[model samples]
Target: MRIIVYGTLRRKQGNSHWMTNGQWLGDHLIDGYELFSLGHYPGVVEGTGQVYCEVYRIDASTLGELDALRSKGGEYKRQLLQTPYGSAWLYVYQRSVAGRQRIESGDWLKRDAVSE
Candidate 1:
């Protein structure tokens, strides 16, 4: 399965190890979504903005591991969205974002640029 990752799962990030067996299909910008700083990591939810993401082709076993990491039924919900790599799974934030800092820049890596 293909997946779009925008936060810790991105290249060189803390949690990217989870994608060790996946292939990087390049980066892409996805619209109609908003990124928020969920502390050390980030979360994306469907909204009015866009987000920078890395597309990957992962196997079923990898998908299962990712689902568990994202807390598939709790903190996030996996949904299929269009990407340059074709339809891919995106982890949409499911909890209230109230009081959280919005990564206005959309790109999680460049999130610091927003306030700089």
Candidate 2:
């Protein structure tokens, strides 16, 4: 299974421990979306902007683990979208991003520049 990660789950991001045993495919640019900083992690929405993401090839077991984490909290909802790497799963913020800081660069690492 292909998973597109834009925030903490990315290679060196904070919560990467949840994605063990996955192979790093490569970096990808997911279109029609924007990234926002929600304090600790990032939130992506279906809108405008090029969201930089890392694609990973994860097995069924890993996918289940990811699904549990993504949905365990009400903050996010998992969804699939077509990327250059093929079909991939990504998490979208379920709450409002009104006051959240926007990651204009669309890069999760760069989000620290303006995040709280």
Candidate 3:
């Protein structure tokens, strides 16, 4: 299976260590979604814009760990999205993004370059 990560799980980010077991497949833009700043991390929801993400080929164990970390059924939900690498899992935010700062640039790595 594969997963699309846009925030801390990306290369050189804080939580990237968790992706050590996965294969790096490069970054890509996913349409029909939006990225937002959730304090130290980020949350992506189905919307009208696009998000920058890194696609990775992962194993079952890594997927399980990621699910636990994302709070699968609570804060985020795993959804199958069509990527350049074919169908992959994307963690969609479940809670309301009211008042949350949106990362208009859609790229978490370059998030600091743009302001809401």
lDDT string for model 2 (1-116, tens) is: 89999999988678888677888888999889899988888889878899999998889998888778877768788798887778988888888899988899999888757544
Q: Rank the candidates by lDDT, best first.
A: 3, 1, 2
- Global lDDT of each model? 0.92, 0.86, 0.92
Query: Per-residue CA lDDT of candidate 3, range 1-116, in tens?
Result: 99999999999999999899999987889999999999999999989999999999999999999999998569999999888888899999999999999999999888889464
lDDT of 2: 0.86
Model 3 clashing residue pairs (backbone):
none
Q: Which stretches of candidate 2 lie above 4 Å from their native place?
A: 114-116
Residue 97 CA displacement from its true place in model 1, Å:
0.4
Write down the TM-score of every candidate.
Answer: 0.94, 0.89, 0.94
Model 1 lDDT, full chain set: 0.92
- Model 3 scores worst on lDDT over the 10 consecutive residues at 107-116
Model 1 pairs in collision: none
